[model samples]
Target: MTSASAFWIAAVRARETGRGAPLFIDPFAHDLAGDYGYATMAASERVAGGENAFIPVRVRWFDDLTMTSAAAGVRQIVLLGAGLDTRAYRLDLPADADWYEVDRREIFQHKEPVLAEHSPRCQRHIVIADLGGDWAEPLLHAGLDPAARTLWLAEGLFFYLTEPMIVDLLHTAAALCGPASIVAADIIGTAGLDAAAMRGYRDWCDRNGVPPPFGADDPAALLHAGGWRAEHITTPGAADANYGRLPIQPGGRQPGRTHLVTASLATS
Candidate 1:
């Protein structure tokens, strides 16, 4: 399966290149996304009815969370399914910390050349592994210390995974992360996956040869079952998540809700 990283990079480019002050700027996004990525994003937007602020808002939220975690002295940051993410270059991460970007081989092949001239602020390691398989092995082999406090980010990743896969991934992450580690992710509710309001999105994925997206109706409960203590759970249009770009009230819940979550590994 082709990694959809490029298309996401295109979305970042669109947001960063906009007129208004953007939430974050990804300077490398332009070269990483290229023409094909932009075309794919445009096609998806058309298929989904219109461009939405979900992607950009989530991007900003994750950026903020990463910065906060880094500042809190959590030195090991792992971006699972890292995609064409340019956080290491864009964010002012801790210089003493190690940033791990884990994804399949092809993603790096496409990313390396464009970022060859650019230098990351922190120690960045590229880990080659498919999330569906034994990714923990490669990640550990890449020098991820199990005893270090880690910030695990699975942004825009859980939706593509099956429920069982999600559980397994969380379990693996919990096993590897040291005490007091943080895990942040985004997940669509079952309503968003199956409700008529999201039918267009489902259809668009099908047309693009991507697997049907998965969702959890109760994201907090799902995280709890997977040995995590959900600290915060909020939808995309909520005040903290939305930067005045979403078309809703500060705390309004839109149709097809996508929940952004922050959790800590359970001690038990």
Candidate 2:
């Protein structure tokens, strides 16, 4: 089977796709999710009340961010944990743009047939490898220009990675990307884990084989320590200004405390 989190995230996209005015529309999400995907949504609804709108909110944010950056002349896009993500097929792209998704071979096995049915909006490449290893060479082999401006998204990925691993990824991007390359990803703050939605998310992760092993209170400081410049950091939580959605679970409600971070490598 595919990763459990993969099923859950895809279900979120599928639900949004079926909505009247979704924050973003992902046409391939339902097909990519398959039967298990819909079942996952039903199961979550029975366990919890439908799916939390948080994942899709972040997805729309990054999707818009990508287009905004691309309009500014960014031609390369990389998705580090590109599981069940339909962006390559859904988004409009400049003719000069290229997209890369680095993930295990198993993940792409779930993607190929779907791509056979649907066309990608941009030039897309799949680099099959463990993200924690020497995947950079394969990325280069697949035609990523380390010196070019790039947009990198690692959404719904960092909380599962160790701090050292996250630092290594930042360092790798710094060494490989040009000075203007921008990266957007989600990170958890220490206070976020205790939030009701995140607490449920953590339980789902542990049951699904991926557990929450890391959370940072100050991603700005973490980025500074990792030698990157934090351009913007915001948490879209209960009654967040932009998203305008409150996370309600049982009786308690707290902020999502998720750091929707955007940053770039600092100049020497």
Candidate 3:
């Protein structure tokens, strides 16, 4: 499976278990992924699975983070690299809030039939543009009010971009945000990259026909340099603690290093 295939597999798993008094429920995810042909690709890999421990952990962390920000009155959610993610469908949110999902035109186009089949539970908008191209403009055009405080989620995406691209992305996000905006992203630190975990990550990428694009050894410095405040930074241990989940053991943790970061735009 490629990176794309891995994501679909994860979505299928989420959809299957999400309805069963699920730890979480994303009723629309599996069906949409299936409509888009990911289900067929994922089927062959399904039988080999034990529990995908990391997916559940990450999902719970994001669930908690989104709820926390919503409680603080966030009215907008921007999901960058929003591939097959079910947050907008599953998370409880205020009625007036808006959710914007950004991704490449090809990917979003692939999702249109799926979207038509299952409308999001919330006000949802899709911005189809390549992140390496003109994504920011399309997001603005999609009714993303930059003046409004928003929670931006860059989950499972940063590693697919180069460091310079990541820097530019943060800078662009900062410029678009109001003072109260917050960003939650996942990362893989240098230490983790150097550990045995890196081997597993490389193998996975190889199996999936993708290459690791980039990584940040220091997320704090990266965000700080891009003009955002590091409100909260956490290792897998810290994230697991916050969500009452267990950290991945030994090589089970994705190698090539990883961490999750939550940052906020500070008041000037």
Candidate 4:
């Protein structure tokens, strides 16, 4: 499978187990995965001692948080580094709400054909561009309407970016979003990038044929520095409680101090 294809494979596994009855319940994710070759990836993980157990759990947490923001009055949804995510199709939202997904050209190239085969139940728009580049321009050009209330998601993408890139991404998002816009992103602290976790992450990267990027020490501070006020920060345990699940094991192959944060763009 290509690097882009591998993304959906991982997500499919998470949706199947994590989103099942007691979990997140993203019915469309599994369907999309099966339609796009992620079924084979799920079987592989099952045989390899369930490599991506955290995905479903984390996705469920993110889905809940995103929905909460929408409930609080966010209408436009923007997903950065979307990478085979099916929230646009899976989640229910206001009919007028617009869901925009951003990712690399290759990711969209792989996703479009599969998704086209199965249309989303909601209003879904795809923006194909690289986050490290001037992708924001296309987003604006696509009628994102920066003046409108929006909820931006940057899930499973920040840790793969350098400090400067992360800064640029946030600043750009803040510039484009209107007042009261909320951004949700997941981050890993320094400890989470320690030897064990780094090794595991590196192994995953190696297998996926990609290089790993630097992890942040204090994401809340970083987001604040980029002109966003931190609203809520939820760790894995906190997410477990918020979603009514048992606390995950303290030490796992994943990084430490991993957190899901929600921030509002500061009004100048």
Candidate 5:
């Protein structure tokens, strides 16, 4: 079965594509999302009592960061739990750059058909493996060089994992990264786990078979423990991350706020 969570996110991207001045566009998103995705998204919005701009903003932020990494000469880009992401097909990447997407076999089976009609801007490698287990070996076997400067993205993925899993994932990526390799991820703060505003969404996740979202109080500290130096961290409404779409103002604490982070490997 196609993952409900992955389709739900694709549904959000599809909505973005229809916006007059969208943050980013994914032409293949609507088909990828399908009727199931739209239904799930509508149900989620009804449960949460409104729409959310978080996913759209998060998508835009990651896109910008990926382009920046490519421009900086990072040749290997990996997306953990890649879901229905279409960066390889949509983004303008360097000719020599190779983008690797890691996710379960089922998701790829569902995704590959939708993308088969499109050509990617860069070399795309699909490594099918369970993220909950030892996926590093498969990635290396797929031609991910541990010596190359790489960009690792864990977007919209960490909340589904436990703290230990998150740590293991970070360490695994760090082990495969060379000096100055970059890692960008979006994480919910620990406060989001039980925040009143997140109750409905949490329930929605539970009903959909997705675990309740959990995260660190200090994501920087967590990254530090895995030998990654947190270079930038910002909440959704912060000046750097906001794209004039957030309902709340740019300052003050927002309930269930997600943090966008960029970190670099501490050493080769």
Candidate 6:
């Protein structure tokens, strides 16, 4: 039951960090993952593969947007389902920035010991809750000002959630975000699930008990329906082009591949 998907991404970040010149250097990444994450990661590399262009590209895109939000005057950040994420410790965020990381209590338990050894770049608040349950109440009570702009990061969260859960989370975000808030999330879709190459990865998720039944044929439209305007939607190919990360595959990229979507509150 401790197969934390966040651990997988943290492992990827560590791999990327060990490189000559990384896209983002998460110094706290390696220890946060600890031994088990690295073990699963080695197995993943043996089976599926290493960190793909999609992951690092998505990471950088959101990092830039987060700084942009801060520059634009948003001082609060809420990382929902924030498993082993170390942005509060790594990013060169504004000194006034406040971060709230919400996750299951166990994730924080695993992360806090590692976090105690480092100095966070911003003020950090940890909220433990069942994200599928009443997670927001704890966050709001923890001093997340609804009237102030906050950058909400969902990252690798939505794929594991069912449709009703996703919609409910979106509505909650919209209600809490106020105007000028930005939300960034990465979502798997029908196209990715249906890909011949992605089957192995799907099997990996299934084996790990995280069956991804929630995906979209049209990710941008899905966000629009969920009450946000997807101002930027980048597919794997486009992200590769942006970061010069992935080589163009043979034939034009197929439809419904993974998408990194960035949106804003549409409460006008």
- Best candidate, lDDT: 5
Residues 1-268 of candidate 3 have per-residue lDDT tens digits of 2336435545755554655455566666665566444554444345434333455666667888888888889889898888777677677877777999988766666567765665566789988877777788899999989888989998877867777778788888888878779988888665645444346556676787766645776677778777777777666645342344455333222334466778887554
Show where candidate 5 strays beyond 4 Å.
195-211, 247-256
Tens-digit lDDT track of model 6 for 1-268: 3235678778889988988877889888888777787876777566555445567777787788888788888899999888888888888888789899999988988899988877888888899888889988999888888888878898878877877788788889888877877788877767566655456666766897875556775666667777887777766556332566676542222356666777888754
> How would you order the candidates by lDDT, starting with the best?
5, 1, 2, 6, 4, 3
Per-residue lDDT tens digits of candidate 5, residues 1-268?
A: 2278789899999999999999998999999999999998897788666777788999999999999989888899999999999999999998789999999998999999999988999999999999899899999999999998999999988888877788888999999978889988888877667756567667777788866676766778778877788898788878778888875445323444578889998753
lDDT of 4 by residue, 183-215 (tens): 888787677565453565567777977657567
Locate the minimum summed-lDDT window of 10 residues in model 4.
246-255
RMSD of 3: 4.6
Ranking by TM-score: 5, 1, 6, 2, 4, 3
Error of 3 at 82 (Å): 0.3
Clashing residue pairs in candidate 6, if any?
none
- In angstroms, give how far residue 106 of model 2 lies from its true place: 0.8
In candidate 5, which residue pairs get closer than 3 Å at backbone N, Cα or C atoms, i.e. clash? none
| Candidate 6 displacement at residue 156 in angstroms | 0.9
Per-candidate total of colliding backbone pairs: 0, 0, 11, 2, 0, 0
Judge candidate 6 at residue 128 and give its lDDT: 85
In candidate 1, which residue pairs clash?
none
Compare the candidates by TM-score and give the number of the best one: 5
Cα RMSD, each candidate? 2.6, 4.1, 4.6, 4.2, 2.6, 3.0
Model 2's lDDT to the true fold? Answer: 0.77
| Tens-digit lDDT track of model 2 for 42-131 | 776665655666777788888889889989999999999888888888888886689999888888898788879667888899999786
Q: Model 5: C-alpha RMSD to truth?
A: 2.6
lDDT of each: 0.82, 0.77, 0.69, 0.71, 0.85, 0.77
